[model samples]
Target chain A: MRQTREFANPPVVLGYATIAGPKEGEGPLAAYFDKVINNLYYYEDTWEKAEQKMFLEVAEMALQKASVKKEEVDFFLAGDLLNQIISANFAAKSLGIPFFGLYNACATFYEGLILGAMLIAGGFAKKVLVGVSSHYATVERQYRNPTEQGVQKTPTSQWTVTGAAAVVLGDGEGKIKIPRVTVGKALDYDMFDPSDMGGAMVPAAFDTLLVHFKETGLVYDYYDLMLTGDLARFGQQILVKLLQENNINFGQRLNDCGIMIYRPEQQVNAGGSGTACSALVTAGYVFNELSQGKIHKFLGIGTGALLSQVTTQQGMAIPVIAHAVAFESY
Target chain B: MAIDKNEYQKTVEKIKPRPPVLKNCVLAFLMGGFVCFLGEVLFHFLRGYGLSEKDSYTVVSVVFILISAVLTGTGIYDDLVRIFGAGLIVPITGFANSMVSPALEHKQEGLVLGVGAKLFTVAGPVVIYGILSSLIVAIILRGLGKL
Candidate 1:
């Protein structure tokens, strides 16, 4: 909340796990997920339960992959798009780890990582588990409509990715290290229509990108890749135009996790969204890219719409935020 | 840099992708007409059973409503609505689906507060306005001695 932070001792990304539903598993990043569950239900009776199960599954997988016992993990920082963040809290209940349930809509990914990295870098915790999950059906039931309701999505609308992703940030010999974080202020540009979150969130992303560059003296090409989550198809175009107007060009190095998570023909109108959208891509796709040396430095930006069904109905402008975390390979 | 909200909205509107309105309209028209055609055929079949014209009309509507309810229960009505656009909407199927969908979805919250109450969440407005306007028209017609 104060300013952009640069960790004197960067926290290592020890291990990560991604659990995807059938739709996300069928995505282009299918192979990267540790577990691509073919069922949306994830063997649970309800979509909400399924999301909680997916959250816990990813947390357990990440802890195991980090080669650390569940008892060794100090804190669980997680959240989702659900009301009151029940998915993260219920999963945390089963995890038995101290938890902080965040509510940044989709930006919980970056917020969690920012705080988790701080906890590790500031010597507050040795191993902090940062995770987030979201489900299409659960989100629909909560924010939009009934899951099975046949209301067709408009072209600008983004589909919520049904998945969960977790990364264990700890002091360890891991390949990826978190070096800096630029926190986003909740910004709104009077953009209405909750369906067009991409439009509403462009300003937040623009501000964070501007501030991050200003704070770190990092130019557009400083990182090998920069990603904004939930900007989707239409959103990135708007962002690109805005950046060009500001005389900032990221070239082809910039991409969005929303676009990476799904193929064009996947019926995802404006690519993918939800809290899991970015985390799944970062933990699963981008993680592989980093480990494979395809990209050395990656800046992952979490862009979120902070609109509830009630607020949206009450004729309020959709407030949005974007947080950036700079990850580099040691 | 501080943002000019108006300028940002213009940028968003410029790049925003619009829904395929013409295509949706075409599909809706064709499918909507097809559903009515089926109803007409059902009417003829019911009329052939020696039922009165009024009874035949009622039976045809009931048949369509029942089919919609069953499809909604099987979780197939919404899929049809997606492809058909407003095709299913103009007919009674959309109403039936709207009623059934919320009830089924909220059943987990239990019957009283969930299913029973939310049964008409979508259709409630339709019923309220539909009857209210109808009653107003009836009163006007009665005053004019038309009914």
Candidate 2:
């Protein structure tokens, strides 16, 4: 069965904004960020509150940038790395918009995009706001260790992006149009290591990309860019090799958000991972390029490792998923 | 999936870069030695102040604990661990850090349930297992009735 939904009328990306942490702000894509918090606390008492604040602010920023208001948005869809998605839930509480909390791990941002677009195209809603955020301190304390703990990180581990990204999608003309969404399925290759998120997530990315290609009957060159969410450098290498073995050459078109966000010297080990990694890149860099007609058709895939602290602690294998949203510019 | 878990794991293992074992060992050795050396220096310094031998050891330990707590609070201990690896982890300072960091992290949760309960989140296991193993060893020595 085809996994992609071809929209009769595409939902346009009306406005988008990105708020990144200080570390991400110092990275190469710093210019694309809408705001960068100078400190990890972001002036909040706790890291959790800091994340919630970012989520709320980024959603508001997207609306303000689009010349839209909270009342005008038909639905708000959001998620994050926090437990019970407190970031999105608290943000929604303040946003006061009709909300749908979604979770697909790091792929949550694309899931939001997909659902928002679907709502718009299906006449369920005229305008939808989608957002996702992740904080390094919040995730580290929950998933790994205390932020101040002296545990050493493995080389394959990724740094979580301490930021948030939100987009305003409307039915009318927008900067870019999302025409299709290929929702991915959770797949596990018995990847159990929580540290090597790229290892756990690569299969899902590979599976989704292949499904999108086969279901849509489109080749790799059909899009100007086929971006993977946050596979980092190692996962990217393995993915490139896997694609080659399958006789599908992505050439130079395959780019990973994790690898693009930070330089190797940033000491992030592998690279950036987390929901915000892909969201920030797509909402800021890719959206800008699409809006400017730099590349007409683009396929952005958000890859996620759907593993939790409980699952990791219990020695459970990581199941991963990737969702792809294809955008076209007139 | 085209590849099973084992095959995929092999692919990952092949692509994943190996951490520098030798370099890490050398660094860990130097750092761990430095930490121990500091402890010894503090012990001698305390003894020179006319503190009892037992009191000097106690003072050295307390001083190290204080330093580690300060470092962890200032957010420098984790970075030092990244470079030094087990050097920071195998000492009393590490124990102090493990305790202090969790307390600091959970301070927002309030005193009783948050800081007090979570203060031993990391070190709790160490204390439990440490005592268990030591008890086992002591029992074996008693069974031997010597040494």
Candidate 3:
């Protein structure tokens, strides 16, 4: 129906937990994260295994925070950037919950959230766990070059966040509630350069945002914050221009998770990316703000550049997507 | 949405973030030069330790390669390259990085199939061409000598 869905009964955010690596832990939102592992390996032999461990940890942490047992959770909705989403699969295996693995690249967190919220709102499940994880080393090797390769990074390249975040969605009342969700269509603006993912995904972010506003009949300033998943500096600039062209300006309320994750001097280049970028930011920063009544209403738009090595190698344009969820403080 | 190629290109050109050429170049120069300087220091050190000039040069090259591989394993070489840009690549350390990086990356696939198979992904062409060109030059020299 090319429209946003407003749930009759909005799902409540029972609890959320964020765990990050050393670099992200050192960033601005370090205090917001629940657990920050200084070691990248995190007692695991490989980076992939470490990411898997993080997913499991965050999921368990979220469940514990919500006072829900693993058996009480109806389904685990999770995703990651790795091939076959091995991290999520392994974590799901350990959690012993019915699993629905998703792949929306960087926007996977929101994808999980929307689906989980729907399950709860539709009365299909009492509780659903939404989780996402991405490791810097793992994503670096899978998406681009290995860390040891020492390949010179383009200034436009965004650093993949080595972190994981999980949220427990329930049918009960809570401090924060997800009222509506806007699912975006896959749009390709003929962006080919993978190194410039922010540039590639900005148009999709704008498109979904515009549609969300139109379908929901919500003004640009309706929410206290309009957060894009991982647009970084360059994508944020492009998004502002795109919004301006449409005669809608979010002004100071607009901030990207990518740009917010790291400081300017951190040398993260364009800033943080991966599924965990927005996941951790929302779970830690935004969730806290909403709980404290600092932000009454907020919109989190997760943007993803659906590019694989195979698609890029085949000379296909990068397909981008953005999904937004409206969260309000109860 | 599909846009015309020319229109898409124009938008990309207008929006794409420009790379900082001057800063990157300076970093590259300093880093690359620093690596070369370290190599020079190693050469002199080897010579001081009683090695001949030629032997010292060889020893320095080997040492630089070993140091680069070790640094890559510890995950320090990548950071150096990140800051130095092309500077680190111009040194002998870059070659070591190119060889070891792929091997380490593919290590998850196991030793033989992963590391052994993909070991030369980057350095393979260089090694093959090097041996081929040297062989060709030697044959040409022999032919000229006969003549």
Error of 1 at A2 (Å): 5.3
What clash count goes with each model? Answer: 0, 0, 0
Q: Model 3 clash pairs?
A: none
Report the first chain's TM-score for all candidates. Answer: 0.98, 0.98, 0.99
DockQ for every model comes to 0.69, 0.83, 0.54
User: Roughly what TM-score does model 1 have, to 2 decimal places?
Assistant: 0.97
B66-130 per-residue lDDT for model 2 (tens digits): 99999999999999999999999999999999999989998889999899999988789999999
If both were scored by DockQ, which would come out higher, candidate 1 or candidate 3?
1
> Which is better, 2 or 3, measured by lDDT?
2
Candidate with top DockQ is 2
| Alpha-carbon shift of residue A293 in model 3 (angstroms) | 0.7
lDDT of 3 by residue, B1-147 (tens): 233456645766797778889999999988888888988988888888999999998888898999999999998998888778789887888889999999988988999989997778878988999999999999998999953
Stretches of model 1 off by over 4 angstroms after superposition: B141-147
Q: Model 3, range A97-169, lDDT digits (tens) per residue?
A: 9999999999999999999999998889999999999999899888788778887778789999999999999
What are the TM-scores, per candidate, against the unseen true structure? 0.97, 0.97, 0.91
lDDT of 1 at A33: 90
